[model samples]
Target: MSEQELKLHVPAVARRAVQQDIRQGNASRIRLRALYFDTPGRELARARIALRLRQEGRDWVQTLKMPGADAITRVEINHARPGPVLDLSVYAGTEVEAPLSAIKGELGLCYETDVQRLLRQVRSRHGTIELAYDTGVLRAGTLELPISELEFELMSGRPAAIFAVARRWQQRHGLVLDARSKSERGDALASLARELAALDADDPDAQVRRGTAITRFWAPRGAAAVTLDDTLTPAQAMGRVAAECLDQVARNAAVLAEVDTLGVYPAGQSEHVHQLRVGMRRLRSAWRLFDGWTAPPPATVLQGVRTHFAAFGQSRDQDVLNETVTPVLLQAGMPVITFEAPPVDIDAQAIAAGKAFQGWLLDALEWSLDVQPPSPASAPEPMAASDTAPEPAFRLDGSATAPAITPTIIPLATEAKPQPLHKLLGNRLHRWHAKVAAQGKDFATLDIPARHDLRKRGKRLRYGLSFAESLLPKSRLRGYRKLLSEVQDRLGEINDLAMAKDYYQACVGTHPQAWFALGWISARLDKLIAEAQQAFDRLADTKPFWK
Candidate 1:
């Protein structure tokens, strides 16, 4: 029952298959990959656990799998098509964190099919792409693409070389390298977990598969995803809020408009400015997806919204740098962090700056929305004077003096009307299988802005879903909606912290020579900001907007 003996349990399928292919005239190549695995905190390596999954496969053969644990079940998929083939897997089990000797001592000699070997089979068929293979050795693929690959890394590593190589390969060759490692298959499974939770109350057959497949399951609580449709003319939708739909979208938009106008307001606090920025972002996202039915928001209006947000965002940034960024840079020995402090009149100066920006925003949203003033750069539209559009339902009718009318909330035919989850989490094995296959490349771009954008998008989708959930049987969808709310709240925290941090850094840099000390202060604050951002990013990545 030793580690060496346990390793021998898996059949030598990969070696044997490669040899067979070599003997045949059809053999294309022979590749070897040594994979190392570890838990998030490096616990597996600390405990000396050698966990790996091997793969080998072709069109006619079933995939082979070798799990670290005897009872482990690994689900995998293979794409037979050309260019950017998809292969995915997930491991679910308990962990033993003992020393290497102790781990070896408790190991049992059990045999299972080799899973990693199938990956080789997949490669054999597609011909290896220039992927950073399991051993951390870079191999050039047929297209000579440079790829940054990752295993279940316990600690982050710098993959600068891989990135460089990939960049060259992309420019010289027709292929592109991808840094994204979280497979779509995993996302689908996670989505399935959420969907199955909703079915457990009535589907007895699904009751069995809950914990085994979905992992730690939780129930839902209150209002969830809300979907607002495009009901009015595009012009009307793009116009001011009316008296009709007084739902979340209108509320969000109004809040955004107010936030934009805060620039012109008499007093602009950092907290108020930050909140306004967030409100505008959430509103913009709602408009992006829902604008299909309504008229698209005007470019000038949207740009004005973003501009005011950016200005306040800048002031907020200065605050953050003084509070967060400077400290990190200082700790990391970055000279910019030690820049001198700004003039002692910082508060007075900020007030002036904030007030001026607030005025511009107010003019843009209020006056601009009403009068189609001619721009110095371009002549005004000939019909600008007559460009009147219907207002939002709520605005047109929210007054007590206005005549009351019934609400008309209808689900579009395109919106899938699925049953909401009831209290208990349950199994729906078939439901997992029923999920449609998604293209994996949809989210390969991972950067601060991309993640921020995703947070915005997820918020929009989550809100829309919440609205739709209301129409479902209350007993079923209520709890799930609550869970969604929790997720949104977590995402919101992360996004806010990130925005604050970015703003702070920029502001410090703006006056780096005079405010070196302020930058140092900002750097120190980043630990908290970074922690919040990470916590939220993890949650957002796991619960994508599509879910």
Candidate 2:
């Protein structure tokens, strides 16, 4: 069977209040102890499959979890176990048997989770949803990590209801969307423990050191990675690409929405915000790539993505200055200057976990996986009569004896035929490359905002070419990509300086130290632009890889 659920993280302060809300529905409380199993080589974890025997009160249930067709769904097979023993025979000839048999090493318990679950089934207009609130500790050897979360599992009806209910809970209890499953966390913890043990094996007092050490939980950091299958239809490619982008957006947003299980935000919270913005931009560029090719998410969803992306802009600007550019200025004999923001104004958390944005993400997820199969071959449009030469109605490529105009020749319908994906991609790539080259010719003459816009265009153009990587030959893109990367890096530095100049200029009235820093940034701007323009010219001259 398949299960669809939206998991959320409850803040440490809000757990009691969340449990109180659950009580209103007459929730049934059960104690759960689940032991996660994986091979010594962690093959199951690598495969993204979780095998566990979880004890629910007195009953023992063995379950196997695997990825489903879409991001939000998972294939979960559960069997009522007779005892604590795991039985592979029960799964023979099943859909999961092949993956199970592929494991070569012996299976052993990696870590265990003991959670108190307050669960209830609620009926709503959209579906029958199960609300499960879990509070527990994950134990690996002597290490223990806390777990507090709420999951809304759809028992029936549409998956949208899960998002709807999740939004309400997030607003009320300050829940953040958590992408990690208990299994993923457990596997990470187990891996860490093994590494720590290996490092201390020769040391005296290793046992005592391990006993006193606290296990810190780190929120999952998702990669901005993409992969595409060349054989996919145009619609499938678009949907899958968008879904991949959304997956990164949601994962990073979750990190910003809430702290780790220990209630501490990770060290690089700003990095999360940065990654979230990158994910949004990637998705936006993908929309441009697939425009008019298929149905897209509603305009409202696109705007919401933009709005939330902008909300994090100020924070990211500050982060780049403080974390990136400031050190360079200081090393260059810059005067003392302080950069800070008023405490109450900055809120990456609220923006990430907001109701409207989360809802948009849910809707966008549906849009991404709603693609139809490839349609039949399309017919050519009828030749038009003109003063200039009129081309033949049919070509010699596909059909025989249909090369010229004839009275008995049949005209095929123009509508409903999906174009060949390769041709469309190739044409679009050429068009974008030409536009980039045209705009980049006079980069130094453009204003600050124009330079900024060109920088953004470069980004989108780079990402578009990247998305076409699998569809084209890898050897062809090497030289062009290197030149593009050089241009991107130089433009990035110029933009950073532009931001730094703005920041210090605002402070010059109150603090005279700002003047020196502003002077330094302004002095470097023209030189960087001259260098960047040369790189852009080279990039513009490179041949399109898809050719």
Candidate 3:
């Protein structure tokens, strides 16, 4: 049978509170001791199959489970008997039967979990949900790890109820959604223990891969990442985009945490930082694209994400200054008086911020899954005609000039009846193209702020295109992406120079070496500005892929 459930990782401190909350309602407490089995070579684990004999009260039940369609669902088979014993007959016709038969005699106890489980049934508008709060310890030989989690299973209703209840608890207690299963964690621990034992018994000439030591410290790998289905509707496509972005954020955060814990990367070489920032930007872009259509998280959550992004940004900025900008100045025959890098603890701070952001992203994903798509009757109206007019041009001093060109009206999908995703995406792309084309007309006349705004538009356009890339022609999409990338690179260089100038000015009072750097950067600014203008012009000239 298929089982649908959601698992949340609860902090040890909050375990009692969750249990107490369950106790206040209709809940039953049960003691459970489950012994997980695997072959000497871990054949079942390799096949993503788990076999456990669980003791509940006076009865023993053997259960086998494997991943279903997604992380929240599983295929489970159970057999209850008077005593715990290997039962090969229970797997007669299942997918795991062949694998189990081959390892029948080799199956042995790998790990065991002793948990105090509190069970409760919740009734809501969507349906009934069975909430299980488990707290205990997982044991593998001499190794032990604490386990505390809350599982919500759909008993007799829509999957939406599980998220609804989860959101309530998350809002109240800050519970983090977890995708790891007990069997997975146990298997990981056992493997790690065995590996360590082998290393201890090996020759001194043995070689270890770099970064292998920290693998166990990071978060467990989640279920297979979500992918966008080509046949999805506009709303469904947006959801898939959000899911993919969330997965990116989680995966990057895990890597960032590992990097921070290991302290392996030097300044300017932090791939984790770059990837994490990209993940956040992609997430923010998706949020912007679907803001009104999807229910947003609380303002505080959004602000928290912004704060974390800024924290990472700060570290990254200093890294660029030290690694990229400083060399340029020296090569240009400019004397550097002082270049101060960010504090050493920046990576650690970034990791902490990332963890908080990951928690919020997971919560947001859960919320998004339960969000109701707007029906045709309640859909939003298209953009106003006046809103399609070209924005006024700005001079280098930031003063606005008269409008020179009129932009084409781009109709957007409404909540009542969203247009086909392909059409909606095309219109959105056209709107972005129009804005970029309008802005790029007088790129040479724009000030730092105006150019920055244009750069942000380019970024948004690029990210937006990514959501529809699968549906678009691959060759055309690739060319458009490359063009967008070139424009962004040039704008980014201009912004960096402008920032370096500002930093030099700020350091004048504290560092005597700022004068030469300022002069060098001032000389380079005009060349960068011209380059940026040309890049934007090229982007404006390129035909829209959506066309």
Candidate 4:
């Protein structure tokens, strides 16, 4: 049978609360003791196979599980008997036959789980969900770890309903999403136990601590290497961009989780949070640039990413208010009353959201990998451009300079083959560059909304260049990126000032103490606008690196 389920890690302290929420009808409580087996080298584990024998009252059940078509789905086979014993005959003709037969003799007990399982069924709008709460100890020799988690198994419903319920629980209580199964966690713990034993043998008096220790170092997985050749098609380039962006998202999420786990910060610093947000923005930009090239990720997946980004942004805003704005006001002798911030455990919240986002990214990566390249006939249409032609050359100050070397444009060979990556990227870069330059031409006279749109255009250009950085010349690319950053920084400052003034204006009516901060921000708004204009002019004068 194929099982679809979502597992969430519940803290021991929140056990009672979660149990109470599902305590409406009569529930069956039973004791479960499962013994796991693997080879000395854990061949089955490496093969993604799990074998376990569990005792339930007077009966014993042997279960075999392996990865299914997707992450949330699993292929499970169960064998029930009156007593516990090794049984390989049951797998006579199944997929597990060959592997289990070969490793049968070498397999031995690796770890054991003793837990009290509470089983109940809850009805949702879509269908029924089997709720299981397991609490006990996972034992591997002398090492033991607590296991308290809530598993929601979809008995009959769309997968979306399960996720919806999970989200509600997540919002109400800070339950982290853990995709690792009990067997997986046991395997990891068993390996850790062996490593610790080796260390203890080397140094008998070496002190070993237990229970959720901080990770000292973390090396995130990097994106797959993409080497462009003359044969590379535009569709292939789009796939590479998608793959790289997904990889970036996964890597940043890993870093954020590490930071949250270690809780390493000085007062109100959150560099990881800021970096993760940037990664999300870059991923979103990549999606926009190649929207029609392939199938989009599920709406739920994208929404989940946005939800996490918003949560992280809230934490970041609070950090800025406490660390930056509050100090500035204090130094200026402003009484900042009614500065109310949420009593949030920012690190914990970030960790939960990061895990959820990372899970979605993994799903996205899998989906992207499965996408077949589109034929030339099905290629996306060329993007539309303004009727007015762009300037022939860019001027740094008053002197105009043409590009040192023009890009080589490759024409499409036939309707069956897509355009070359180099040509497609060059055209897109030119369009983005012209759009930004045209918008910035009247920066000082444009309204706030128009300037904001220009800022977004500049950002899109910057992110697109970053995606194709390997294709561009190094020297020119560095200068172009630097100039773009300068413009973005200035525009960001102006926006931040406007937001601060609005925030203070809203608070001043209620507290009256924020009037001084509001007046101070209002006085600098015009100067900031002028600075933004100069920055935009500099950006407009810079040439596109791809040229």
Top lDDT prediction, candidate number: 2
Model 3 misplaced stretches (Cα beyond 4 Å): 19-75, 81-114, 120-129, 138-145, 156-164, 171-174, 183-212, 215-226, 248-280, 287-363, 377-420, 430-434, 437-445, 489-497, 515-547
* lDDT over C-alpha atoms for residue 434 of model 3: 88
lDDT of candidate 1?
0.34
TM-score of each: 0.28, 0.83, 0.66, 0.53
What order do you get sorting by TM-score, best first?
2, 3, 4, 1
Q: The CA-based lDDT of model 4 is what?
A: 0.70
lDDT, each prediction: 0.34, 0.80, 0.72, 0.70
Global fold similarity of model 1 (TM-score): 0.28
Q: 214 in model 2: Cα distance from truth in Å?
A: 10
Minimal lDDT window, size 10, model 2? 211-220
What TM-score does candidate 4 reach? 0.53
Better of 2 and 4 by lDDT: 2
Show model 2 residue runs off by greater than 4 Å.
Answer: 199-222, 262-268, 338-344, 371-417, 506-516
Q: Model 3: C-alpha RMSD to truth?
A: 12.6
Candidate closer to the true structure by lDDT (higher is better), 3 or 4: 3
The number of the candidate with the highest TM-score is 2
